[model samples]
Target: MPTQPATAALFPGQGCSLEGVKPLVQRECPDLYELCLCLLDADPFERSGDSTRYTQPAIFLASIARWRGLVRRGVRAGAFAGHSLGELSALTAAGVFSEPDGLRLVALRGSLMAQADAGGDGTMMALLKGDMGQARVLAERFGVTVANDNSAGQTVLSGSGEALAASALAAREAGLRAVQLDVTGAFHSPAMRPAVEPFRRAVANVELGVASAPVFSGLTAEPFSNLAVELSEALCAPVRWRETTLALARLGVERFLDIGPDAVLAGLSRRNVPERAVVRAEELDVTA
Candidate 1:
């Protein structure tokens, strides 16, 4: 038998649409879909209308459903990594907790993050054609913070509405394209600090198990040592995705499977490690 490539399964954070995932989940993982409806008290398939409280759990269910399909096909990974909100999904996939337990935690995390920025004055913006140096300069000038280092060329900043606007204008003047993200709060910034302790306490209450595979932390670009503490701290820390991808490559991950609602992570993998094979769940034949 041909040896399987060293693979890492990646879960994406928010900003991608869950357009066709409902049908996929309903067809392949009905129990999880129903559980989502029961726990959330709404149709998980319906549009979230950009509400973080709804989008978080919806994304989690979609990712897990796709992962289950992969598992049925005997696909496996050596490691796993998730971006921001996707980390909870990664933990569940790695057997750190049950799916239902993960769902409940994500639901509460969403609610806390949403409530943390009730005024809705906090937002995030992406900076393109810029390096981390420029991103840091703009962030310092505007009193914002770098939320995600998605790739060498793409960085996201999070802060107050006024700060983001000022940062965007500065980025444009500096010859970088600035685009505002369709998110509800300044995630990975000080604006999310209010949710940190509550989320930490909630994570502590859950029963955690040894992961079936190593799960890398976006905050530290290393395998998780303390999930509860790291997960909560991740709320206000930058997603070192570029570094995380590199770390995975260092660990001999030659194939990256993006097991999420969309191809967001796959796209990032291509840019972050072009030599590696990147596959999206949608591209796989799950009918077997």
Candidate 2:
């Protein structure tokens, strides 16, 4: 058996992009194009270049492909952590499901989340260095809501754009680092309640198996071998990413690998785990 890595492999969530990835797939692994197309059930490359539905699966395909390529080069992971949608990819890589099932779940997730967006014009903001206690107080004052309790120092607020903007300004005035996120809707907030039932029903229909490695839950900050119900709730739950990272670090994970397109999670991990070594596999140049 291959030796397990001392690090945890991290996968990024929604904001990761797939630009210029199709050409790489076509050039290096022509076989993947047809397989991915079949999974998408449409000509995503020809249609709207960067639709969320297309981007979601595209990121999954690219991330998993990178993982396979790395394994082909003899890299193996011992533990896994994925941000939001990346969790499914991490689960799939850890043998919780086959690629086809992972693709199906991604498709269902994208469609259901799109439906959730139609419920309201809500937005998300990342507030840095703000008092969680005071932020909650501010949210209550403005009728807004706390969406993501990400790290010890970071929390995300969600509400109508006007409301979010107002809250952000207030936070900034109060000396907090606040910035809006570029997302379709206020995900992980009560605003996504409209999508919960359909997404939950869809996930319950899938069969999830046990993972070979420890998969940390961003919602519960605990390890879960069961993927179905927990993953469904993660779609709209406050991502306890900071807690997850700290917990993983406590388990002697001194090295971290971020397997997704962007380095956001890796960067966040660097900030959160300054004592650890972090490697972003996808960001590295691929061998010919």
Candidate 3:
């Protein structure tokens, strides 16, 4: 018998917009659109700029809407893992909480992250073609944290501008490519310590359930059962995306379907697990 194709659904993190998905959400999920309207006070695509306060919830709604569409078409995922803010979207899609409640939690998370960012001048930069161990050494020396371990040679370092600049220069001296990100906060690092406790309370207040599908956590890079414990620590921990993808692949995930606006995770998965297929959910032919 032919091997069954195992798939994992992926959601995009912050900095990705809902512009590409707004129409779909409005057309296919009127309830979700109404909730977004109440939460954001406008249609998701109405706000074009990337504000952390709005970006998280907007992306979460859009990602979930896309996943709902896939489910309607009988697409079944063996596992799911989202990148950063995408994790909330993943949880919502996996039946952990109602959409409205999940949106509220995401809003709180974004606000707390923004507040934590106000404590200092912090940011993130992607270091390309660098060894992870070497990058960790340089990051530690400059007090920056390796925020996102996306792939083998791709790692996102986060901290103050001066710290990032120093690390970038050192990385250049070591023949690595360093590019600054457009985000305002140093997310997934110790810089978000201020937000951790409050977000923990918010998550604790929520009614969570066992995941309908395996949810590969960014914190543990394994199955997640306790959102309060795992996600609270995620506020001050690096996103172990590379390990998550490897774990998914090891569990027979042959395809990763990007259900958010951008194909960012699909692109990242290409670098991490080139042997598997990566596709955007929107690209699927639902009409068939």
Candidate 4:
């Protein structure tokens, strides 16, 4: 028999919202629209623009839809992974939870994070280039925290706006590149602690199950069985995306399928695993 395609499915996080994708989802998946409507009826999207609850559900639907869409077209995946919020979607796709349950949990997560953000006054910044150790040191010096280790040189810093500003200035003075993020709160940092308690409580009600495939944990940079607890830890923990991607690469995963509305993970996978083949769910139909 012909060799099965070496495929790994990846999911994107917050920055995955691309132009025109949401509209496409609304048009193509009527059930998805209805589900979104139901979610709106409960807490409503307008109520939580920056809520982790809202964003998480939104991302999960987008990703799971794309995954189902791809499966409909005969595509197959051998492994699965997601970045930050995308990990929950990955877990669901890996058979950890049903679609409906995952969506509900994501919404709750968004709500908790949003409420936490309302209370904590903080900001996020992306630093490009320079030493990771140096970046961590700088963040500590300012009492800020490293929110994400996205790649070899790309990282996100989180803390009070003043502290973020101070870090940015320091980085600039040191000739390091940094840019402020357009985010409401300091996600993936200690600043998100307020979101943690509610999230833990919300997750306590969830019925989590074992995943079918290897599910990497953003908090541990390793796979774990107790996915619910691991996912809860991820809320206030920085995403070690670079390490996760590198681990996948080490496993000889040459092809990546980003099952989400946008190509955020596809792009990052390309950057992180340059030698591998990275394709987005949206781009599949166009391919021969």
Candidate 5:
């Protein structure tokens, strides 16, 4: 029989929707569910799910809950990676901290990012059918920042709304499709600099433990050498997700399990490693 491929667990960022994850969290991780309710003062998935203050914690809780379910099913991963805000979930799942700490950190991060973007004209847009080279050219021409290198063909730009709009026009003119993201601010760019120091302090206070499995940073595509520093710097640094995905592949990850509410990371994995197996949390029959 052919050998089963090695697996890596991936977590999604703010793009994840909380549509079907509430029940899973309630069922598999009631403590997390209750904690989220207490932290946010409401069920984020049921309340203002679009707000960063709610979305970040909601996704973190859902991802961790799914990770717990995977653990119960004996699903082991050789490594882990998360996109943007999902990095906290990855670290927690890797045993760097307790789930409660992760949840609290995520809540603070969301609140800080939201406040940083408050009353600002910052936003994000996706450049599709374009490579990093083209994205860089647009960024240079329009004074935007390459926020997310999501895949070979999809890169996200973040900056002032006017700058992003101009970049979007230029991308479309260059035959690439540009779509505006629903985020409230220019995340992963200079606009988030205001939140960096505060988040850094919060991360520093947390007691971090060595990870059970290597957790690659989306900011650098490397195993985390210093959690507090990297997590803080990641606020304004681009998410090098494409590089991180390739790094996992180079590390012999032939299967990717996206332990988040949505299959967004699984979709990105397919784009990065088409020959490899990609599975979403929803696909696993963990109910047994």
Candidate 6:
């Protein structure tokens, strides 16, 4: 008998684009593209670029299209994990919601997030060569929030522009690369609080159920059993990507497939769990 593959599908959140993905899953999985047309009146994969509103749905399609391709090739991962917006993709892939429904939810999510951006001077910055302790120290000192704990050496700080600028300066002074993200608002921070209620309201209209396959939650860094509250709380909670990936590794996931636009999560996994194999699903020769 063939050995079971100890693999997991990793989905990425925002700040990652799928401007020109390979193999062009659009021709195959037109459902996502059609939904993008319905929602934005444009092909997100083709024109989204870095706009937060368009990027959300585009990333979903980018990730889900690869997921559909994997399913066609009979590659079934033991578990699924997503980092933020990726969580919704995971939920959709696990069948918690229909593809169209998932796209709709992400569209509304993107809009609310855009509104939050226009509401104030929010921003996000990346801290290179910083660990949890150092990031927490900076967060406290600069009054910023840890938007994403991507890896041991990389953390994203989010909050008001002033705080982000100050935090970036501090990182540079400490011999760290501080790069401001292309995103508009301070996602995964208290600055996103305003977007939460509207988002919650939107999710309420959409029916959510338990996923058919186990999905690791970005909020709890564990398998998600509930959707309603976890998603609501996800708004202001930092993405625990490092711990979440480690949790999958502990669960015997020897390999990780980043089923999304960029190989970011795969790269993060390689660095965070160097012993594990990480690759983008689309790049894999699924035909073989």
TM-score of every model versus the real structure: 0.97, 0.88, 0.92, 0.89, 0.95, 0.93
TM-score of model 2 (CA atoms): 0.88
Which 10-residue window of candidate 5 scores lowest in summed lDDT? 42-51
Tell me how candidate 5 scores on lDDT. Answer: 0.88
TM-score-wise, the better of 3 and 5 is 5
Clashing pairs in 4: 52-110, 53-109, 53-110, 53-111, 54-110
Find the 10 residues in a row with the least total lDDT in model 3: 42-51
lDDT of 1 by residue, 138-195 (tens): 9999899999999988999999999999999999999999999999999999888999
1 versus 5: better lDDT goes to: 1
Models ranked on TM-score: 1, 5, 6, 3, 4, 2
lDDT of 2 by residue, 1-288 (tens): 855558788887776666666665566445655776786677555542444566677777777777777777767777888888888888888888777778778877876776777756777888898757867977897878777666667888878888888888889888899888877777777776776777767767778777878989887877874456677777777787887888899988878888766677887888778889888885455433
How much is the lDDT of residue 168 in candidate 6?
82
Better candidate number, 1 or 5, judged by TM-score: 1
Q: Kindly indicate the candidate among 1 and 3 with the higher TM-score.
A: 1
* Model 3 C-alpha lDDT per residue in residues 1-288, reported as the tens digit of each score: 666479898888876655566677777667877876787675546653545776676777777777777888888888888888888888888888778788888878887988888857788999999868987898879988989899988899999998899999999999999999878788888888989888888889988777788987899999886788788889889999999999999998999888867767888899889999988876896422
| Cand. 6 TM to true fold | 0.93
Angstrom error at residue 62, model 4: 1.7
The global C-alpha lDDT for each of the candidates, from Candidate 1 onward, is 0.90, 0.75, 0.82, 0.74, 0.88, 0.82
What are the per-residue Cα lDDT tens digits for candidate 5 across 72-183? Answer: 8878888989999889999999999888899999999999999999998988999999999999999999998999999998999999999998898889899999999878
Runs in model 3 deviating more than 4 A are: 1-4, 41-44, 48-50, 286-288
Candidates 2 and 6: which is better by TM-score? 6
Error of 1 at 191 (Å): 0.8
How accurate locally is residue 92 in candidate 5, as Cα lDDT from 0 to 100? Answer: 95
Runs off by more than 4 Å, candidate 6: 286-288
